[model samples]
Target: MADASNFIWYELMTGDPAGAARFYGAVVGWTIADTGEQTAGGVDYRMIGRSDGGNAGGVLALNAEMIAGGARPIWIGYLHVADVDAAVEAIKADGGAVQMPAMDIPVGRIAMVTDPQGAPFYVMDPIPPEGGGESDVFSVTEAQRVRWNELATSDPEAAIAFYKKHFGWGQEGEMDMSPLGAYRFLQRGEVMIGAVMPLMEGYPVPVWNFYIGVDDIDRARDAVTANGGTITSEPMEIPGGEYAMNAIDPQGAPVGFVGPRK
Candidate 1:
């Protein structure tokens, strides 16, 4: 079984799925395939498949109802839990709002939620694989895969408290950005999956940003700009001799990319 608080899935909710497919394919070298699957509400969903034959994430088209209700293109992560109902209850008790009630799906039960500072994400109890094989969904060390998750929120300390209450995350380490305060790294067990920090001034509500891995940061950054995506930040080096950038895809969904310069 996977760890209680590990992020097991990533998804994109976009206004234009086809446009997103083309842009991400160029930027991240992904092959977007039609899963021929629908949500419990019957909306069309697409799959983001990695080159290594492992599934990376999912994409679903925003429908009329969602658009009318002010839905926009965005990427969200799904945190796996052992029990959907209990997780939802704990989330509410810890100052989170349930955007979607717990419900059954083909693969698992899921509930959409927002933390106290309003960072939205999914909590799911996935159905175990048949014949007992592990699902290789995430790989921080693999190129062309989701390598990191980040939460830029209004209050990192309070957000950490709420998450710890429900998901059992602990503060593993932190980086001091004097002007911006601290970048706190969070871990579920031994694996360092992501970090949380204060949302920069003038940014909208709290949101999670996922970093997809690439073989070469420079090449991928160029691909992003060449493919109609806007590079919000130029490539910058991190602790592991890797570089990363933040960007907004053509459809306006924000995403990040990480890897080396070569």
Candidate 2:
């Protein structure tokens, strides 16, 4: 089992759940199924399944009330913690804010929170199903799984420190982006999970970007355009020799995909 501070789940909160589902299904090769279960506020939740029979993430249908409350389409990752309530308090004490109070669901207790720099994510104390092992929603080399988790923040140093303190993440190394800033890699024990970089110019606010893995970068890029999504950044080779690209889904949510050029 992955201890506290690991990303156990990923979720897409979108206004058009069906459309977003189709887009991701085609691009990332996921099989999203409606669970037919209504959440506390009557929200429709769908489960994302990878081709290998493992779970990928989930899709949340945002209601008009949630949108009226300033909710927008977004992809958010969930970090597992031992105690949700304690984590919320630690975050608040560190100048972070809670978007949703701690609440218990079928899975476990969860609370929506933002880092001090205002990037939002969730903290969950999950209750594993009978005999179920750890979650493999995040992977380094598997298609349809989240390959990387990047944080674009106004204060990289502070954000890095905050996550390190709460999640026990360590800054192993970094890549220099020159004028933009350094891209500091974050690791949990031996796993190089993600990185933290300066929030680039023109982006209105700080945010977390998760890159899902694909088999072919070009094919995925084409799928984005053919399915009504806009390519924000063309595929570019990264450190590990794989290519990565950014896109905005039809409903205005920013997303990323990484894979080989072929």
Candidate 3:
């Protein structure tokens, strides 16, 4: 059992699988390929490969029925847990809601859940491969990999408490954002994985924003526009002197990128 209850995998749920594959492939420099596997309902699934030849995540093609049932284009991260069912029960007890009940898949047991603030993510108990190894889907400085996992919620205090209780997370420190609120950094063990901040007025609801690392910020910005994506936020210098920006893909999924300006 993977005892580390941190983000291990990510998946993008999009209506147009092929188009999304192309869009992200160009923007993030990821190699997207068909897994040749389909869900029982025939929805296609593709693997997102990083430049390092490791698995970054996956792209799940949402079918018509899924879309009609309220599924939208979004990127959801999966947190590895010791037991999926137990995590689900504990989450529910703490005011979280289960979007999809725990179920067994070829790789492991997984369940979709939403925090009290309505931010959705997944919990998984993975069946390790022949040689047990950890996932490197997230990295703070690697290009073509997830660099950060940020949560924008209506209630940051409650959100912090919930994650800390469930995942053994901690608030290391915070940066004052003035009128917006404090940006509290989330620490899993000793690594600063991400942060949580109060959701601003413009956002309709709470959501998790994953920022993918790139080699060049300017090149990425150009690719996003050229590939039919909209830049919601222009690239700005972050505390670490790196640049980060938010954007919406052609398929309407929110995404972010971080890197140097070169």
Candidate 4:
């Protein structure tokens, strides 16, 4: 089992699972594998596995009903918890809203929820691995793994407080973005996982964005454009000599890719 409050799984709800599989497979070098899993509604779910053979994330094809109900393609991270039901109650008490109630599945219990600031994510208590504990799916320097998680919310202080109380997250460091104010890095234990900041003007809504690791930043950016995705910005150098870019996948879902320039 993954440590409680850690980000255990990531998932993408897409309108075109096959096309997404193809696009991501090219850009991120993941091997999209059908998990042979189906939801209660009979929709198929697939896994995004890394080249080194670890599980990365998942993809679920959106049905017409889901699309009709305003389900746009987006990626959501799943935070690990010990008890889904108890966590749901605690979140509601803390002013968060339940988008989907906790439910039992073959893998474990899960619920969709939004923070007090209305940034949405999932909380899950996944089934134990057959032999024992699960391996880490996140790495600071590994290609094809999740490298960072970011939140753009209406209230950065309140959002940080909420996460700190519920998920045991702490502020690792801070960066001043001047016009953008402060960008706060969030850490769970010793791992610096993500950051939180105020939502910028003109953004549609407060939400979390995750960055996937890549080996070559320029080639990954090229792969994204050639695979029908849009690179919203030029690759920029980060503090540690790595490059990162913001992009929208072919389905219009925003994602980031980070690595060194080749």
Candidate 5:
């Protein structure tokens, strides 16, 4: 219960759930935690999480209603923030839309928002920060959170404005990428929390993709498909010789795990 780095929880909203559970088990080294029911957004939800009996995150049975006006499937990240209300106010003042207003949950107040470019994500005051909802709060290990925060949007200028206003997350440095204005990395203080990049032509929607850390990429990729998951990208090397793969769970929710290179 130290940092947001562990990404303590994860959730999938998918079309084929049973298959997703099986796929994730293979791709991710996790076992089944629990499956339960809930009613929200006009559809029922199936809770999915880390097999380690931890709050890895959850999965929901997606329906036409859940998608925007019945749009395609999307995965949203929930980041733990220190203060929910202040965060919400900053997001609003910075031109971001609050899709779901702040509401108190068993853990603490949670709010759903679209960064200036419309990438959907939720911000919450975790139980530990709010007191005993999860584990006690401590600036513990700089645990490696597989799903680190990053946003992809058509309008990154506005996007940066939104986060800086809300969470005080501002640009760290920009790396020149020829045609694509430099790629911008963001920071929460000195910690690398997320990034912002221009949306590619024809690939329109602005969204956030979660990144998971693993020890092996090729093996993780095979495990994903073998376990019933679908691979969107094959094992590839990222900078520094690190390798990774991207895929969609059996439920069609985008997922990726990163590992050290050979």
Candidate 6:
């Protein structure tokens, strides 16, 4: 069922929104649109966007209140769920914490969740897109496995269970990743979604990194650093020698880009 609907919108919320807009414009090829803030619970929100001319996502101002409440800066993925209320309850029952209670958005309903650990992911039952990726019972999902989400969780077993109960996601298998660490690719039937790793061991808070597929790895690596992104792990040759690298976007969200090794 995984399709464009499962992950239609993504947002990068950073302290410096202007610098972020410019950096991403160069990296992901997305245009930005700044619409003045609209108040929510007395909070002013500045709107940022790709405006359909670039990629399909936006940039939002980080919530100081949440940060003060022990929230860290990160790029959050809001997956589309069929029923928000039922899904939230199921999550709590399965040991996942509902960091932010379910709230209504103009687009649909959204709720933030932590997988036993504190890494937060957003879930929204979209209003349905006119076309593109949408999850179904038998449809092959993630039209572009080009970009996927990665969750650095404490327990791979429990993580798999939690998602299986909530969204029917399953672990396809573990492929050797060598020096970087073990890689257990995840999927929802045929739809390629994300990866599970041990990056945030024992922190009580998990780290979820997004991966962007580029036609050329070297060019993407250059694009990242050129746009002010930090390369935590430079592109290295995998054992059999394929090319891949890790970097943090201007907002400090870790993402990876991969392609054939030269």
Each prediction's number of clashing residue pairs: 0, 0, 0, 1, 11, 7
The digit string of per-residue lDDT tens for model 4 on 187-229 reads 8888788899878853579899889999899999989999999
User: What TM-score does structure 5 among the candidates reach?
Assistant: 0.78
Clashing residue pairs in candidate 6 are: 1-135, 1-136, 3-133, 3-134, 4-133, 4-134, 5-133
Question: For model 6, what is the C-alpha lDDT against the true structure?
Answer: 0.64
TM-score for all models, in order of appearance = 0.95, 0.96, 0.96, 0.95, 0.78, 0.79
Q: List model 3 lDDT by residue over 15-55, tens digit each.
A: 88778878988888888874537866476888888877899
| Model 6 residue-pair collision total | 7
User: How many pairs in model 2 have backbone atoms within 3 A of each other, for residues 3 or more apart or on separate chains, i.e. clashes?
Assistant: 0
Report the CA-based lDDT of candidate 5 relative to the real structure: 0.64
lDDT of 5 by residue, 132-233 (tens): 454311112211235355567888887786666555665878777678776788775666655788876533688887777655677777787777677777
lDDT score, candidate 6, position 163: 69
- Please, what are the lDDT tens digits per residue for candidate 6 over residues 153-227? 767667766766666677777866566467887886666766787654223457677655444667667788898
For every candidate, C-alpha RMSD to the true structure in Å: 1.9, 1.7, 1.7, 2.0, 4.5, 4.6
Prediction 3 global C-alpha lDDT = 0.90
Model 2, CA-based lDDT: 0.91
Q: Show where candidate 6 strays beyond 4 Å.
A: 1-5, 35-55, 130-146, 177-181, 200-204, 236-242, 259-262
The parts of candidate 1 lying over 4 Å away from their true place are 1-3, 34-36
Instruction: Give per-residue lDDT, candidate 5, residue 202.
Output: 30
Q: In candidate 3, which residue ranges exceed 4 Å CA deviation?
A: 1-4, 34-36
Query: Which model, 3 or 6, shows the larger TM-score?
Result: 3
Model 5: residue 101 alpha-carbon error in angstroms: 2.7
Candidate 6 weakest lDDT stretch, 10 residues: 136-145
Compared with the true structure, all predictions reach lDDT values of: 0.86, 0.91, 0.90, 0.87, 0.64, 0.64
Q: Return the lDDT, model 5, position 232.
A: 76
